[model samples]
Target: MNTTYYMSYKLSLIASLAGLLYGFDSAVVSGAISHLSNYFSLDAAGTGWAVSSVVLGFMIGAFSGQFIAQSLGRKKALLATGALVFVAGIFTAIPYNFTMFIVFRIIGGIGVGLGSATAPVYIGEISAQKIRGKTLGFYQMMIALGILLVYLVNALVASWIPDSQWGTDYAWRYMLGAMAIPGCLFMGLALFLPESPRWLIDKNRDDEAKSVLTRINGAGYDCQTEITAIKKSFQAPAGAQAQSESLFSRKYRRVSLIVLTMALLANLCGINAVLYYGNVLFENMGIASARTAYYQQVIIGIAFFAAATWAVVNIEKYGRRRLLIIGSFICFVAITLLGALIWVGIASLWMLVLMVVYILFFGGTIGPILWIIIPELSPNRIRGKLMSWATFLIWTGSFIVSQTFPMLTDSVWLNHLFNGSFPFFLYGLFCLLWFLLNLFFVTETSNKSLEQISAEMSQA
Candidate 1:
């Protein structure tokens, strides 16, 4: 309602558009996969490569994103990421060959990696603790929205274009290139956002930090208190030597391990693999046609959007660890049942229902909470670096799942062993593992300030 609150919201909203681009780029390929495969005469492996290449680029970008953010500041880094997404989108749409398409997809993936690593960190840094979870949840919500929008676009484009044109090339090209619109918007808006005040303080720009903090905290709020806390968070404890510390340093090792484990598990549970190749997965599962699969993807996107919206509204109320554990458990059940249905040759419609249920739980739980918890758990001084590491691991797991799902599902040996449902079974197993990990290792951080979380991690 106040100037500070409005500005904070506006800035976070702009930054969160990066998530939209990430989602669009990630899911747009779903609609294009069959068309591209047909056009290029791709084998299963090549098809997998086309879908997973972005995640590989995402891994590299996330690995380097922290350094880029540290050197150029979050705003500049985000601007650069947006530009990359725009260029990658245009080139990807117009690529002359399969190799060129893969290259450009990787370029766009680099943008996704950069945006994924930085946007939530930027939102986390700028938001007040009271509303931080919801603010960061905005990033996840945008991601869901982007996925939903792309699915709709894919359906609409398929409908508008005749089968002759849609089958040849234009439909998929248009679908992939449409991302440039949002990419350009994100780049344009990044110019108006203030640098993370925490980043400003890290750079020893106290006056500038304070100016931004005042705008965030508003009149009648004590910006000085938050400023002092931010300073204190960066100060080394008594008798501790100040030096550049590795992310795996003794002080941070436990937290880093926890975050990395969570990140790895989140992706290993096969959420993105399902999302990126949803249409293909459904078709393989006996969906009537590619158009029907596309429609099913739209339904999945709607469920995802609904669940994400609910998570955004209630994350602060439920606490991160609780939601994660519950969500993982539900996903575990849904995935296992879905696999059983496939193995037993149940009605395809029931499998679709279970898929929706899996996404519902995923969107509400691990989908959004992973972003919130990683940043919340990190100490401010190294939050960016640690987040980058965690995100890199997340993408690594995603890359593995995305690249392997086709092979795993298509493998004759595994098919004989698992009744052709090996991938879902594996995902279910990871969901159970993720639930146990969260239950045992993760601590609740609801209502805690960043400084308090830092102090707790230091003590641990």
Candidate 2:
């Protein structure tokens, strides 16, 4: 096939809109949680549940994603997710009772988790080798774009109201409802885009896959050669069955271990803690007001955008493991600096810079790379199912972090442990540890195709 950028770019860009849905839904609730707590007359634990209910939904959705994706096909699975999100974004905004509110929010959570799990996998399968990393990074770019949109929307929603009115019953409703616009967009765009060629091939739709590759690579593209290469890649002794067996067998233990560990490490590097609870952290650090803190949250979103764009532009040039290694080291520096600033009582302005810098480092590398690598790491036979499992673990890790951060900061005396510096220190440790781990084990996957990667890993 002629490996041109035009077709791949369009598909990757469209698929990435799902990222916007994921990012918006994930962070939108943060701004609304406090206001909703008051409206519902809830205590800390109740509020905790309000915030975590979505994550619970994510876990449920992720656990079921393999079956859903396998049965529905990638395109249909994503479309189903988008439809759920469309309903969720609007329903979540209604002036219903707390029970109703939680239920709808859970619905939205399902959309977020399922889309987040499948979108990049779809992109990874269809993209040509030359631009795979950049295209894959587009998923993270869309995610950051979604985050930025919600942050701005959240700030705008809160900003319009008087301080006294900010916590009123209606404030949270508008914030939660704002996500509907993009959710609907994703649903509509998904309807128009082509399904993954890999998926079509999996279903023995070689003619369709040829059409897709031809479309992607232009009419002159050699559909037969492309199809043969794709087929041959799966022709090794292990073939599809061996790929499945090795995933759980001792034979592929190392591959299985690497995928799981990388997923955990991705979360542990502290991106969610920064993205999800950033506003709260800003306030805890004496950022002065909600407005200031919210704006700072927007800056974090901006940094994520800039970094993701860079990753998309350079991922192939830098390769996966190198980006992770470099990014992890940079994050170590950023977080360490942040911890030191808090411990030494650096200027408040400096503290915000530290946070922004940390996000910048992470956005360029860890955020995008996680999505880039996981799909490629799995064998073709179990790619969808195993990737679904990986997605579940990612959310499980996210849920743990989201639920614990507040308690850690409030109950465990994290501030006292390091004199208001413990969180950054803890994050720094994880980043540095990830850096060393990548140095030793994470394989370089820049120019290599999935078939090549599998061959090397199986031989090793």
- lDDT values for all models: 0.88, 0.80
Judged by lDDT, which candidate is best?
A: 1
- Which prediction has the highest TM-score against the true structure? 1
Can you write out model 1's per-residue Cα lDDT over 1-460, one digit (the tens) per residue?
5554787778888998888988899999899888888888888899889999999999988988999998999998899889999999899889999999999899888988998999989999998888889888999899999999999999888787667645656888889989888889899999999999999988889989989987777767777787888988888767663532556777878888898899998989989867988988888778647677888899999999999999999999888988998999999999999889888877568888898999999998899889888999988767998999999999999999988988888898988888778888899999999999999999999899889998898664
Q: Which residue segments of model 1 deviate by more than 4 Å?
A: 1-4, 164-166, 238-244
How do the residues 1-460 of candidate 2 rate in per-residue lDDT, one tens digit apiece?
2346788988889988888888898888777876887788876567666777787777777767777777777788788778888888888899569899889878888887888778888898888877888888999999889889898998888788776555566788899888788888888899978878877877789989888888888888777976776676555454546544556665466777788777766777667778877777788777647667778888888989999989988888778888899889999998889889877776587888877878988999988888998888776656776777788888877777777666666654666667677767777888988898789978877787877776666554
Model 1 residue 459 distance off true place after TM-score fit, in angstroms? 1.3
Name every residue pair that clashes in candidate 1: none
Question: What's the TM-score of every candidate structure?
Answer: 0.97, 0.93
How does candidate 1 score on lDDT? 0.88
Query: What is the clash count of model 1?
Result: 0
